[model samples]
Target: MSEQDLAGKVAVVTGGGRGIGRSIALYLARAGADVALCSRSNGEIEAVGEEVRALGRRALAMAVDVAEWEPVESFARAVVAEFGRIDILVNNAGGGFEVTPLAESTPQGWREAVEINLFGTYHMIRACLDDIPAGGKIINITSGMGLEPRPGNSSYSAAKAGAHMLTRCLSLEIWDRGIDVNDIIPGLVATTNVDWAKDRSSVESVLAEFEGKSPPFAPSERVKHPDELGELVLWVASMPAGGPTGQSFSLARRPF
Candidate 1:
């Protein structure tokens, strides 16, 4: 694809304040797409919006909690009003809110994980579907844990697993509309979300801790940079119209 492959397009990235969302948002902007991004962090979202503007693209940043239908609906309206249409939507706002064992976890906390990871994705897509004309792309950021269950992360696993199926089901339902819906599994990323330290500011700094070795979770797996996922997302986003849909693209060494 050319450097300006996404020129004139508008992309919406959730959890765009930092980590994978931050990288993907900037990558789309550098490729010539105007970006509309949101996250719960007002300062982080606004900072990313400025970065997009600095790269010479229009940007709309808001403090939106993707799990809430009202905010998501409002965001969709704002995007249409500001950018006129939505060309790409990246559903990346997710987390293991309560990482306790399912048997011992509180009902609300366990459900909150599903609410954010799965319902949040649904809200963004439903809200923006009308504005996304033919040839639009919807990429859901999934996880290996979703494909295969992980201990103490039952809620996130269940939520992402649901999203995985949603991508496939949505693609089949929307095939006639010419939209491509797919999943991106960013395995062992060095995002603060994965790091136990909770210090999520710099991707490179986190990766540095693992230098020439692998992360503890996977003895043979090397942690990946957030920018690498950006590259993969760019490739998927740059695919020709009417291209592949309902597929899972992964960046991990281990098999899912």
Candidate 2:
């Protein structure tokens, strides 16, 4: 409602079609950043772009699969061409139920998870490296599970943990260049994924049995919302000059 940081900046949010990604995109736009939204679906992302424009900031929506190198590169180039430069990159497009036990998981499923969660992030980071100028920021969406392993989420946990490390490594490597890189480990947030499970009686049954707790831990007293995560992201991305970098922060109150 008032003038905020990130005004006149340009940001790209992968998986900006819906859920947390959509929240992040809108948050940035509201803060006055020209935003580019990308996802595998054009319609949903375009809808998000419309919201960005309504916020009085320029918007571009592109259908892109971050796992694919070519499309990722093209998306980066398009963002630069349309906005002139990239000031922020949010690698948020990664998740799935395929994080089953190793014995029950298929090789293809394993690779797919890794490719999308790990390699996809790599592609976007690589493509945007040159476009990110001094004072730019890179934020990777990691899972709390990545900080502490989830027994049944081998694939998801591995990829996210790798991504967390990747963020730190990139931060160290690029700090001298004046680019900041950080990772956020968000705990359970009520998103469409949770909604889908709620629709399926089986998922609901499982959840009910757990008493709202993640495995290996007590039931979560509260679940975070997507917009909550988005707010934290917008704040960090729009941090004033000399803000912290090469660090990881968790959204949940869990002691870690």
Candidate 3:
């Protein structure tokens, strides 16, 4: 698609202050879409908003925790108030509280995981359902761990799995409305938020390893950059009203 395929459209992205969300927000802006972004961090979202404006697109940045319904609903309303309509919704804010065996996990940890991943997506979708027009798109950023079992990250995996299922169900439920719902499962992406020290490898090495594996979605055998994922999001968001929906796209190697 061209950079202006999404011209005159309005998009909302949760957790759009940094990392993958930030990339997606900027990409949408570059593609000629006005952006409304929310995250827990005011500074990050504001920075992103400035970047969006630099691209000659309208932008609104607000502080919101997607786990809570009130703020998400308010955010959705605010976006419509500012932009007049919502065309794309990207649910990208979520993380694991802890990586540990179920027996060793705290109840709070599990709850936090579920709330941030599954419920967070649900809240964003529900809040914006009415605002989205007939040809709207919703993309959820899940993880490869959700597709397969990870011994230590069960809580997070379970929540993402639930989100994956929700994507399929919502796709069917909303098909009559011309809304498409899909999930993107990223594996071992190198982002600023990742702690390289914990992995005992440089970003270059990680990229090399990932490329050598010949992942399914990456035929170029190159490291998957955040902006590249943003390109994929743009493709999905620009799909025709009756195009593909209820699908899961993965960017991970086997065993991820």
lDDT agreement with native, every candidate: 0.91, 0.83, 0.85
TM-scores of the models, in the order given: 0.96, 0.90, 0.89
Candidate achieving the largest TM-score: 1
**Between 2 and 3, whose TM-score is larger?**
2
lDDT of 1 at 95: 89
Rank the candidate models, highest lDDT first. 1, 3, 2
Ranking of candidates on TM-score, top first: 1, 2, 3
77-168: candidate 2 lDDT, tens digit per residue: 99999988899999999875585799999988888888888898999999999989899999999877677866876888888889989998
Model with the higher lDDT, candidate 2 or 3: 3
Writing each residue's lDDT as its tens digit, candidate 3 over 34-75 gives: 999999879989999999999999999999999999999998
Candidate 1 lowest-lDDT run of ten: 193-202
Give the clashing pairs for model 2: 213-219
- Comparing 1 and 2 on lDDT, the stronger one: 1
Residue 241, candidate 1: Cα error in Å is: 1.2
Q: What is the RMSD, in Å, between candidate 3 and the native fold over all Cα?
A: 3.6
lDDT minimum window of 10 residues, candidate 2? 195-204
Q: RMSD in Å for candidate 2, one decimal?
A: 3.5
RMSD of each: 1.4, 3.5, 3.6
Model 1 earns a TM-score of: 0.96
